[model samples]
Target: MNIFLINPPNCGRSIPEERYGITSLKQIFRGEPLALEELAGNLLEHNVRILDLKADPDGLDRELREFPPDVVGITGVTCEANTVLQLAVKVKEACRAIVVIGGIHASNDPGFFNHAAVDYIVVGIGKKAFADLVCALESDTDASALPGVMRTRPGRALERPPLRNTVADLVVEHSPNYELVSRYRSHYILEKLGITMGFVASAFGCPHRCLFCSIQGQTGGGYLTKPIETVVRDIGLLVDIPVIRLVDANTFGDVKRATALGRALFESGLKRQYLADIRSDTVVRHPEMLRQWQEAGLRAVIIGFEEIDDASLLAMNKANKASMNAEAIAILNDLGITIVGDFIISPDYDEDDFDRLGTYLDTRRIDLPMITVMTPLPGTALYLQEHHRIINHNLDYYTLTNAVTTTKLAEERFYSRYAALLANSHQNARL
Candidate 1:
């Protein structure tokens, strides 16, 4: 089968930019679409071509006309859900290919893509499931019974399959087809440092279920890791890339496995710097594991210190405390590992709340403070709890920087404060 895997373009509308003319708040995503590449890797028997619309936004129509694939797979996040459907329509209009939509958004809300444009919706870690789906389609067999895959039915509730997120679903044996995106390699760079970066998924999903998190949809609330050797091999494949972001929700969820992986990376001497997500509690409990990883070229750790207070943390079901977050920052600083700290700003914040958060960031030694609005993304616990308050139903503004719910303060004032906080926090940002 001739398959075309598409990575959606830099999408998601910013409310601040669109409504208040706050241009600085709009986000521009830059990275290789590792998900699509992984799916292509498993479809080695087919002629696969990856069209990264992010790198070449105008190449889609040309590729469709020239390649004319038999199967078209599209992947995207919550904010890109609408755009993914539009792309699906374009593909449907251009060719006779079966359109499949998978990724964070589709996995979370499979029914959202059950329109005529999309034939199937893949719900979880889709490498193996997608391969099975492609095989079924090519052989004219029924694929509706595949686990973690749903045959789209418009205006009807989707019958979701039991998510089979075991290690087999990872299919780590076949490394991601990195060469498929080689032409877009130079476009994948660390914006701050202007150095090339590659993505290598050492793990998937997250152990913790923060109320506002969407990662659980990827693996049905399971934590799965690739073998250390597989991880090392994936990193090695990006030969010239200097930085490798282990694009896992939580890379060090399994402390023992993470420790061994660190030792293995150290032994393999891959010599590539890594940036990975680790919970603050993980850092507090297993500081030595981080130490070993730091020695294994772990340059930075992205920790989600979502809130500054315990009450807020508990409300969000973070299962962590502010003290743990502070201590982890100190420990990472002591170990010389740059900290890329993530902080969430609630729409319910008042003047005092903003002042308090700003004061907290001023006192912390975090290398980079990434602050985002407290968005109640659909399919998250927070969304369920706050759905009644959502005023913006548009998926385009679900960019995390936008508040889908009503703000405690005036709308424009809330965005102004957010923009100001971002500007102030980024004044001395690093890493």
Candidate 2:
């Protein structure tokens, strides 16, 4: 089977949906296109080839015209819906290949199957679903029967289970299929950023039930994680890679596992740096774990210090740790791990929040890469709650890099402040 996977164009000046301003910080790193690559690797057992559009979108048309693949896979998030819409048309126009679209955006909303360009939609983790789709295509089976998929028929949409039965093993033993990315490396960010490709996930599912998050609805509202040894092994395998971002919704949710992974990697002499999310309460439970992670060369922690004041924190349901946010930062700083605090700056936050937050970071010298403008995303608790009031229903704008909310604060005021924050940061850092 012949296959192609794409990372659609990211044209926003900010991170998708304006979630956070860390886009300017290369250190925070753009998410690697590992999902499609992993999906590609899984397909390789069947003599299928995967092409990365991220590495080469321009050459894609030429390649598609030449190879005329039996199947093409495109992965995307909310931000890429617009691009995917056009790209899908272009794919079909270029060739008669079957098209499969998968990602968070597609998974949460099964409506993508209705698109004329899509033959099948893989709604869950791409590797397992792609493997099934490839087999179905090879044998000419009814592809809709595959799990986590929904096939478009004459006038009907068939839904399959989109949940990964064993999410922990999705990226196991996977390589980026560099040959594929190389074909399109002209557009690939990894080569330019000097970052080697690696998995960004250690866990899946969100339990917080935040009103604005879509993760739970997409992944089935539970959690999954790999053993610490698996993580250590993965790290050891990527020692030559500059970094391995733990892309878990709760990267360090399992304190013992993360601690063990850190110590094991450090003692293993793997010099590669690591980055991940750290829950405020979780990390505070074991301060020594911070040092353990740092000793393992942890460079940064993308932590949720979301709301500052008591009322706002309570409203945000972010009182998970009460006052532990402050404690977590102090500990991580003492241990020499860069504190890349993640916050949802809202109108509810008064000057005290900024003053205290700024003073805390300054005193600790924590790298506050961004104070994100919180926007409710589909499937997130916020979306489930306030979605009725959302003026914008465009899933494509839900990239977290733009403000898509008609929130407690006026939309214009919220966005303008966010835009000004970006401008001010740009003036200072010019990232």
Candidate 3:
């Protein structure tokens, strides 16, 4: 089947891309290409062609018109939902193709599938969720029966049992499909410093229930770990790649697993450089474990240091305090691990608060703390509670850096403060 997998024009990242030629943060803003690319390889057995639209330079209409696929699948994010809906509407109007949307956004909030243009909505892990959706679409079967899916029928809507959220048993082949891994080798090269980056998913769930985060709730809490050897063998697939990235909600969620994974990476002779995102509290829980990861090839960490003040911390449901972020930075930096820190400067903070954060970034010696306007995505608690306060409903404005809501600081000061942080991120990358 001819399949057109699109990353879509990142409406959320548009402002930043226009300003700096990069979306998200400069260092780790490579965007979420790895998941889609990997899914493509997993899908090749189905004889479907996959395209990474994020890396594509062609104009939207030009590409869609040129090569219409039997199905056009979009990985949905809250910030990108509006764009996805509009694009799906256009594609359906222009061609006879089924449209599907998946990813965390659809999984957390399947209601998005109500879009008439969307033929099927896949939830949960893409590997199984997508395959089932494709089979139903291709066979003209009752797609509503497919697990982890929601679809509309002639007069009623059909919602199916979410696929048993199992991380194991999904791998059809004994091999970890590198089909997706190979698509963006060049991009990983730059991120890993001319080294290829392999995706290594060690765990599936987060134990922490941060209100602002949907991960813990989505994965249903406990950390699901693969065999240490399986983890080792996965890295072996990317031994040729310069870097191995752990795509866990929190790879280091389990210290024993983290240590074993690190040990395996070291033993496999593939531990030159690795990267992953994990919370500061998790890191503090096991200092030696991180040291082992560093010894095993961990060069940097992408942490969620959301805010520095106690009230801000409590409001976000972050659970961890500002002090944890600071302590984590100190420990990790002392251990020689580079941290690509992330923080959201919301309407909740005044100019003084922002000034305090800026000073904290410098005083803490945070190499690159990527600061952003607190973005209330559609599915998150932030959006639900504060939807009325959101300044702009346009999905494009939800780009983490955009002030979708009136922040404590005005638009000008917020942007100016962000500009300073961006400079710091660039400087940190060089350092």
Candidate 4:
């Protein structure tokens, strides 16, 4: 069977840009479709090809005409959910292939994709579940019984089998078929450093449930780590890529596993730099582990310093404190490891709030301060708590940079401040 996996294009409408003409706040993401690559790796028994719309947005129609796949799988985030449906329509019009939707959005809100254009939705970690789906499709058997696989029932609730995600769901043995995106390799560069970077999943599903976080939907609030050997092999498969971003919600969620993986990387003599996500508390508690990782060519760490105050931190249910975030910043700086700090701006921000956050970023040693508007994404605790306040129901404006709720300040003023903050913070971004 011919399988075609697609990564949605750089999408999502930016309120600041579209409304206030604040272009600085609009983000353009660039990366290999690692999720699609992972699913393709498991479907090696069948002919598979990847169409990275992020790299080649116009190539979709051409590819559909050329390959004419039997199964077309589309993956995207919440903001791209609407676009995924549009693409599904295009696929249906162009070919007789079955349309499947999966990825972060579908995994969290499976019912959203239960449209006539979509035939199935693979929830949770789809590496193994998607393979099982393919097999069922090939045999012309009922796939509705498969765990994490849902048959679309438009205008109705989607009832799926309970998926108890375990280590097997990762299917690390197959390794991501990185070669599938070889043609788009040059497009996957780290724009800040202008160097090629590859993604390798070291861990999945964060242990801590930050209210605003959607990672728990990936594995139903479980922390699973890929074997150290598997991680090493995946990095090795990238071959010529100089930097490897450990694309995990929290790379050090399991300190012991992270410590062992750090040691393994050191022993393997891979000589490649790595960037990974870590919690502030993890760094404060295990400074020694971070030091070990630094020695193993850990160049940078992305820390979620969501807020500058403990009260706001608690509001978001972020277990770590602002003090811990500051301490972690100091530790990483001392270790000569770059810090990519992630900060969230609330729509309730007044002049004083914006000033305080700006002051905090100005004083911090974060090499790259990534600031985003506080968004209550669907299928999150925050969303459940704040859904009533949502004014914009359109998924297109669900980009983290947009505030779907009413702002404490005037809407235009709110976006102006956001644009200013982003422009000021990125002035000295190093990585």
Candidate closest to the true structure, highest lDDT: 1
Better of 3 and 4 by TM-score: 4
TM-score of each: 0.99, 0.83, 0.86, 0.99
Clashes of each: 0, 27, 5, 0
Off by over 4 Å in 1: none
How do all the candidates rank in terms of lDDT, highest first?
1, 4, 3, 2
In model 2, what lDDT does residue 24 have? 41
Mind giving the per-residue lDDT tens digits that candidate 4 earns over 4-100?
Answer: 9999999999887777788888789788999999999999899999999989989998999889899999999999999999999999999999999
Higher-lDDT candidate of 3 and 4? 4
The total of clashing pairs for model 2 equals: 27
For candidate 3, lDDT tens digit of each residue in 50-163?
454555535567766677678888875677777778878888888888888877777776776677788877766666667767777778777676666677442465555556
User: What's the C-alpha lDDT at position 45 in model 4?
Assistant: 90
| Residue range with the least summed lDDT across 10 consecutive positions in model 3 | 23-32
Off by over 4 Å in 4: none
lDDT of each: 0.92, 0.64, 0.68, 0.92
- Candidate 2 structure quality by residue, lDDT tens digits, 286-370: 8788777777878777887776556666777765654787787778767767776676765344444445655544444446456
lDDT of 1 by residue, 103-215 (tens): 99998888789899899999899999999999999999999999988998898888877678899999988999999999999999999999999999999998888999999
